[model samples]
Target: MARFYCDACKEEFEHSSPSKKEYTDSFFGCCWQYVAPCPQCGKECTEKKEPQKKKRTSSSGGGCSSGCCGSCSCCG
Candidate 1:
């Protein structure tokens, strides 16, 4: 499932279709457009992208304890 935001409805909705094409075709019967209609209000909707998570950085100086050694499996 995917999250979508509708400008007309001013709300967020969930879509079961995995891709935009599938979502559009299932709801609007077309796949050429980039935006999909909101299932609640039948208005143009855009897919909501989830924020990417940032990797935690070590504050300690570089060494085996920093998880950069071969035993840590961080530096293959």
Candidate 2:
């Protein structure tokens, strides 16, 4: 997790730095987008990367945080 200051809105926000895979995927996708909430502006901004196919689309462009298992998980 990392924090960034948005000069446009003059706000500070805590953002999770995209992983290598996320960066790569976003870079390859049409728009490498990262979601981060601006503290001062209270606005959500998309951090664009190189742009690749959007990664983690199964549950709406995010990873499994509910502890649910996917096909890849044999335990599931």
Query: Candidate 2: minimum summed lDDT over ten consecutive residues — where?
Result: 18-27
Question: Which ranges of candidate 1 are over 4 A from the true structure?
Answer: 18-35, 58-76
Best by TM-score: 1
TM-score of each: 0.46, 0.30
Whole-model lDDT per candidate? 0.67, 0.53
Q: Could you give candidate 2's per-residue lDDT for residues 1-76 as a string of tens digits?
A: 6555566786555677632323345456543445666756756655443447755534432335554444335434
True-structure lDDT of candidate 1: 0.67
**Backbone-clash count (model 1):** 0
| Candidate 2 all-Cα RMSD | 14.3
Clashing pairs in 2: 27-50, 27-51, 28-51, 28-52, 29-51, 29-52, 29-53, 32-49
For candidate 1, write residues 9-74 as lDDT tens digits.
Answer: 888888775343433466667465335678777876778777999998764555555655344555
Q: Going through the candidates in order, what is the number of backbone clashes in each?
A: 0, 8
After TM-score superposition, what is the CA distance of residue 49 in candidate 2 from its true location, in Å?
A: 10
